[model samples]
Target: MKWPWTLQPFIFYPQGGGQNGDQGWLRAGAEEWTVTGTRLDKASGVVWHAVAGELPPVDTQLSGEVDAHSRLRQMARHTGEHLLAQAFARINPAFEVAAVGMRGPDCTLDLRGSPSEADAQVAEALLREVMVAGPLTLETQLVPHTELGRYPLRRATPLTGDVQLVIFRDTAGELFDVSACAGTHLPLGNLAAPVTVLGLEHIRAGLTRVTFRAGPEAAEYLGEVYRSARALAQGFNTGVAELPERVEALRSERDRLAAEQSRLRAALAAALVTAAPVEAYGPVQLRVLSLPDAGLLPAALSEVPAGEVRAAVAGERCSVGSGVPELDAGALLRAALTVSGGKGGGRAELAQGQTQQPEQFLAEVRRAVAEKASWSYVCHSRR
Candidate 1:
């Protein structure tokens, strides 16, 4: 069910103006209705207020009020749009207002042309000039389309009947910008406070969108930027300008420490090669050593004499090398535990690969030694 209530002396600005509707409360003595939004019908010239809860008595004297803070921000943005359009033209005389919108605290204007960085800066400078200028008074009134030719209109309007012409005039009544518009604006329909040109983005072919913030929104954005910069500078013990240099220095120091730590770890792990348990089989000494560093495995095998062989392991990685000319430690290691999706490859005397079972790899090394020595392998099982 919808109740179309007629409000008198309405403070709510209906949703148009390239911005959202005003939100607030409609009161009837003790009972209150929350106005969540307002919608205006351009065709019927009727305004609807979307509210929560049941409707109040008809013909009941009710009061309405808008969210004052939000209303001010939106008014400032609407005012900023006219200034931006004129500023954009100052940079490129041929530019046209392809689209414009005011959402919350942000305002955007899309022009139908490419705008370079320098062009944006020049426009932004002009935009700020109007934003910071002395109190602006908008001399606007309704005028027929036929009389548009008398003034220096900013753009042509398609409206056939009476059009609302926003006149930029001086105290002496000299004209400046004259454009037809229907959106809500400041009393003077100009920036109430300074504005910030957030940035410009090339959306696509020949369309450049300029985003900006005005009044309280602009001041808040600048405040947040300064606060963040100060926090970063304080944390790094440097000025904002030197922040990049300080960060680079810290990164270099971290890399140097990591490299030094790796060298020390590899040196300490080399001791594991000599610590491995050895099995003597006539002429060959078979050593099995498992360490945490794979790079140190090659150095460990070098510790073995000319007639010895070593199988060094680090995590899932394995390395086998033999000083003996006849034994292929590479083939022997792969054959020991070729189970469970494991694979290996190397020269006849050395091989390095992954193994699921380290103990199985060691067993194969021992078997190769026993077979070479022609010794019968015996399994001792406890009964």
Candidate 2:
């Protein structure tokens, strides 16, 4: 039998402007060969199929097989992009489809102008309509430059030579977009599922980029997004729709609690001063009290009278004095209180210190301050 390579007529080229070419295997008779790669020759505009395994003679015929899965993805994405672009033209007549490019997972169209939210919604609605319209017919024809002015066709410049144009027509006899595209497409419009516009970006002053997904790929992307949202809602113990509200409520409660803490600290400081007492420190009068806790120290210091009262607490002592400016009262108190291995210091007249035994601390500080005053008195009396 003559070589049956011509029986399989499907040929894929790697040089598709909108998408990359397909890759797979080829079989002829009992021999199987692997198709390593494919590339489009710019010189001849024909696809060069690279294969591995045994090579047939130069004129030998072989069956060509393209990867179906890859082909379907490209078709869905490319066609979906066209539908989206048509919608853009409908919403804004000034918007022009600048360029269309395709990759494995998705396709992109550069628009001459940015679109608003309303424009995007209209585009999405039109895509839905195309998906429901069923199979689409693809026709490629070479028309004279003068004839191109009749349809909504995009042209860069009149071709001096033969010009190739690809047109897409839906089942309703409605034309979606007519452009000079050299990409593969589905036979029927319904082959591509309803497309979802993933995102839009303003690339430059007048250019916008739109990305979209179609068919099973669209379904899978949406499924992943919903799953993540559900997991987050469960972790926060709120309905998915109420997450924003719940977050705001928690923030408000935290602020309220912080204010309450500040008020409590102020009240405790005031109460400490009300509990101090007056006593004699040798010749001068001093107010000495062992504070119930360190929390009361601020309030106790605030209550001491200006000069007459020299106050010190043994267990958690902080003192402020109004009289006896020359005495290093704070230092004296810290030193006397240090017998308990506690540390404290303040200014000459106002000092604070802490000790383990509150009673012993008060007694030591009082005796130390008195003794020091006595030494000063004796020295002054002789002079």
Best model number under lDDT: 1
TM-score of each predicted structure versus truth = 0.62, 0.56
Residue lDDT tens for model 1, 1-383: 35376464466888885888888888978889888778777787678888877887778787888888778887788777777677788778777888888976778988877877777778878756654554467867888888877877777778878889876653345564677887666776345456678888888888989888877788888899888988999998889888888889989999999898767766676666557677887667788887876766766665445878787778778878888766677777677657423678888778888877776777776777778744422321221
Error of 2 at 270 (Å): 21
Instruction: State how far residue 242 of model 2 sits from its true place (Å).
Output: 5.5
Q: What's model 2's overall lDDT?
A: 0.67
Put down candidate 2 lDDT per residue, 1-383, tens digits, no spaces.
12222222347547466677676677768877666556665685555666665556666667777778777887788767766777788778777887777774556778887886667778888767766766567777787777777767743544545566777787777776687556666666566666777778888899888777877687778788778878988999878788778878989999999788667755865554445555554455666655556655665565445445455463444554445654666766666667645777777656666566766766666776677666766776789
Question: Among all windows of ten consecutive residues in candidate 2, which has the lowest summed lDDT?
Answer: 1-10
Per-candidate Cα lDDT values, in order, are 0.74, 0.67
Please report, as a residue range, the 10-residue window in candidate 1 with the lowest summed lDDT: 374-383
List the candidate 1 regions with Cα displacement exceeding 4 Å.
1-3, 8-10, 131-133, 170-176, 188-191, 241-383
